[model samples]
Target: MITKEKILERVGGEEYLIRHLVPTFSSKVRKKNYKSIFSEKDDKPSMSIYKERGVWKFKSFNTGHQGDVFRMWADYYGLDCRTQFKELLELIDQEMCLGLNAERKSIVTPKSIFPNSPTVKDPAASFPSQTLRIEYMSDYESFISRLYLKYWLQYGIDQSVLEKFDVKQVSFLSYTANSGRCLSFKYFEKHQVVSAYHISGRVKVYIPEIAFSFSSDPYFKGQKKSFSYKNQNKDDVFGLVQLPEGNLDYILFTAGEKDCMSAYAHGFSNVISLQSEHQMPSEDLLRVLRSKTSVLLCCYDNDEAGKNASKKLRDSFGIVSVQLPEDVKDIAEYFQRYTPNDFQLLLGYGVQQVQSITVNPIDTHRVRRLSNTKRSKVKSYLSNKFNFRLNVVTQEREMSTKRNPGLWEKINVNELRDNLDRHGFECNLDLINCILKSFFVERFNPIEAYFLTFEGNEFDDGKDYIRRLAHYVHLKDPTPFNTRYWYIHLKKWMIRAIRTVFEPEGINKHALILCSPKENIGKSYFCEFLCPLSLIRYYNSNPVISNEKDAQKSLIRNFIINLDELHQLRSNAHVIKTWLSQRYVNIRLPYQEDEITASRIASFLGSTNDVEFLRSDLGHSRWISFEVESIEYIDDEAKYILEKSWEQAYHLYKLNPGSGELSKEELLELSQRSDQFTTKSTEAELMVQYLTPSTKELGEFMTATDILRYLQEIVGITIRLNTKLVGTSLREAGFDRVMHSDIKRYGYFVQKGLI
Candidate 1:
């Protein structure tokens, strides 16, 4: 059972044997020869190693003696290759720790073979512990023939990158729980393969003879692919050897060798990889790296294991952790799905400080209201009493906190002054401003620097928030008409509201409109409650839109801008629509000298006590209108719902921000369902008296002009027929738009009905 092939496979291939047999052999050297070990003393170094037919062979020109690795191994023991081949296999299996012996008898290695070998003390020690003895082959034919390069190519990794990282194609791999000739990737250190990372299942091998002679095609067979690591020498890091010397800005440590190479292929350098996410370099090695680089960033697989490992590295060594999207497993797969620029956008989110502190809000309130606090005590009071925490935390153009972990806005000096003044603490404006600047520069805890958004609550999962939102709609609009789409719109709006808090630039274009026939329906009160209590200061129920600039300022400053009395804005419909569509506002605050482009963070919520608040014209899709029977007072429930929902939304947004986006199809469906809320036009009602939608038995295809002319002449309608109104009326009267296929023109399918 212990054959030469099995021994060779266990010790890595022929290439591995040669590298290990001759310790002085350097694969990097070209046309270089080493002194022959077979001869007693050769005057000249005449033995050279070269590849022949996918195998590594050695030859000595001095004595005209040369053969494969087996011949060389036998010659080292002063035995003939042909006669002593069996003994050579046994010696290899024992010395290399192949564990191939069936009888469990320990055959001693020949003293002559390892006469000066360092591993002679331990006969089974051919490689360094925990490192791999990876086989290397220069035969591009085997690499191409096995079709192993395609796996890396699909992840945007080319042959050059694979070769750069010393990745080799393995046609045959034998390990525990796996033995096959399937195509796999072997990661080697110089000439010896240490680790194996399989990217795909078994690939069909291209048999040249079978294909060229037209005898048969490539064979298709499937095998259980595996990922494994083996060790031969101390060199474990994949890209560490290739790293440039000293003083780098940043170096990325990825989950695997492929992820490292993938980053390099995407135009990022100074990157290295671990054996796996779980394996980290020694403390000494990490310290040396820290001195050489400004920052060490680790981007591991998006799984729980990778996340935990990355966090450990961050906590232990101050290495920054870069988070990957939930869908991607690793950086290689990330590049496969997204562009390099998309990855660059995430780099800013990773450069965070190692430490973060949390301050108690109750203590902060107590500190702010202290009567004895003077200029000298400002720092101590803010730091100790107010419980202000600080850190250099950046998350996609905003500060991210550990407690509330999303984007947050930094509070300006004016806002801080206002807060202190309101809390009954009197301090000079200049001193207050100076202390704030110093605190900011010092990178104090997050709360002192940025405005606090809603923190995630463990008890709430957002289901109640969703339930309340659904119930809120049902209570406002008791009618069964379009209830399904209303709920759909409400869910989407809530998602967008959450998104706006995290991603300020993400505009929530649609506004929820609550209409009622009577004034006592509590529409405005519910709209006011839509904003969370924490953000109630930024909620304006009576937004003055008379001055357009003021309206823009309101949008820029507020979290929720309620456009109350929707009927009062009938003449301002075009302006309101324009405001709804805007993603940014170009305006200057009183504190700023020049106008600055600011993102629109405000979400609109409207209320009206008029039944026909909506106009006859189109462009009402942005107004999510509903007729309310009544909105009963549920103050406590509403506050709890708003607060908890925001927290839940924040959690969900962090997971996937793109989930808030509305597709074109979804918008169109919502738009169609919104038709019931639009006030009916007089012309539409008049046309409905005589016209009905097409029936198979009787109908006529007519253009808007033709329909208007018929209504004016045949029906003797004296009212001035507006062209656009006629088209709108036709659709309103259940006249379906149809194409006159023969004439190649669009017309309405209509039939004459009794008045």
Candidate 2:
């Protein structure tokens, strides 16, 4: 039952077992005064048992041959320590079965290679008819030695020169194409050749489908370039990274495309997906990554062959494995939920200008009844309000590959539903559609219609995206329960603004919001509390809203900004706010003109840097940052206290639909208390207080940056202001003048670079 991997690790390999074990045991047993081991006519072992110590058994496919059933003939041929191994393989079926599972087949197999039992993920299939297992340990080498030495003496070793061979010979695999499913090998040492045919002795040979590593090195230094296929056909299939002299950086591999597909789907898109049936070596995959930016494998997942292929592929990218999620079953699914929109958020641009936008939240009666003149006005309003230029790019695509087979197969919705009910999860259809939709909705998440096909590798993203969704939901409601449990807790709170806009009631939108305490608390927690998608989408779309004003809306309609961890981000001495802010806002790669979106945005921040939000981008107005210092929450634990905290946003949204909720005093307090912007000295504070305009005007608000920088300019200077000046409604022609203490000293800080 030893696995192909474990077999190679022992007894040399499949090749060695074929050429040596059978013969080596024969010469020794016969010389020990044992009867001839085989019948002359059939050439199959015919040894008999004496019901004593060291026994031998012959199990082979030749006797009434059956599939994978290594036949057992000799039951208990007793010999002394002279014939231990032959007896051990006969008695070791229980242990071997631990590593691999074979039925009452012709051969005894170690149990590790097959299912621990006949049942798959289904438990009902586990029973005596389908072998069940309860233990898991494989001391392979020790077991090998114990079995071999038990029968080694009977093999008649030449003691003086046998010490090296005395150690259990590890198994090595060899490929043979001439015999279907048969294994064979001949040994030629530095001086002599040893062939075994009639010498197969009392033990029987159990052949397996051969496997090989593509290699051509003189000493098997790398993967071989040639392969053995059906019909004994020879093919040139593997190639290494060849230099000018034809030397390779490493060996290349030959494996089914399915293996490479799983690797790519799991995020290692750098391995070649070959058409060969022979397994690819781990080292070759590592080489492929070094040779290219991306690689993919596409293969069918019919059995263990597929699972093993992916395991080896992942192992090739060992460290990067940590970068992948544990639950993804295959590739297409991984990308399904992590569209490009989420990337920008991770790359540090989820702030004011990186937030999600709304374009005409609802279709109004006016919009529906507009005349041509009014239509022109409406288009103009859209251009000014949303900052988007509309256009359509369309072209009929010509097929470059074979025509899709499914195209010829007619289908209807009911048929699709039936097929999906049985096989859709395997293909990840719903999730793929979601990803496709997200892509079209955001420029940052441009969609690609792949040569769609159903394969196991398509669902890798399901596990990871689901986990993220669950985490978001958990933040809103810590209780571990079903979906309905969450809806109950959040329904009332979500109803305030987002409820009627998401489903039967309304449409829903995606938005990024940041929250923070005065300077050192709660932003990360706040991000968690937002319930990013799942929970928010559920209740908001129920039969909630009852208004004609809500009809003709976008697929998305309302959003909230949550930023409780802002304070925590500010206090970290080394790249603290930088890391957190990077994930929530900014354009990291100025070289590219495309907008950043979603999780991909998170990774683009690289390590750390300042993330500046452009006030010019239409993204600015969609988000609303809340200051923890400007507000307070009543502690509650219906599910989690954070849910109660997030409720404040709904209240604000109801009070003012999009951008007009927080009052003037709230904003002023937030600006003054923000740890990221304040000057430490009282003089600096006074300078900041002196020139500030006392009006709530939009144009004046836009200058807040220059005003803060000016304060940064006058930090050490003495200044005074008529603080009462704030009461006046300042004129719309907004302007500010910088105040200074000693004009001479002011330039000194600038000269010394302290300012």
Which candidate gets the maximum lDDT versus the true structure?
A: 1
TM-score for each model = 0.42, 0.18
Best by TM-score: 1
Model 1, span 173-241: residue lDDT tens: 322110111123333211111223321101111111112222122332222222232322112356764
Writing each residue's lDDT as its tens digit, candidate 2 over 405-504 gives 2222211324433544464223234532322222111111101111011111233322332222223332222334433332322332333333222111
Q: How far is candidate 1 from the true structure (C-alpha RMSD, Å)?
A: 24.0
Worst 10 residues of 1 by lDDT: 200-209
Error of 2 at 719 (Å): 27
Candidate 2, 647: how far from true, in Å? 31
Residue-level lDDT for 186 in candidate 2 = 23
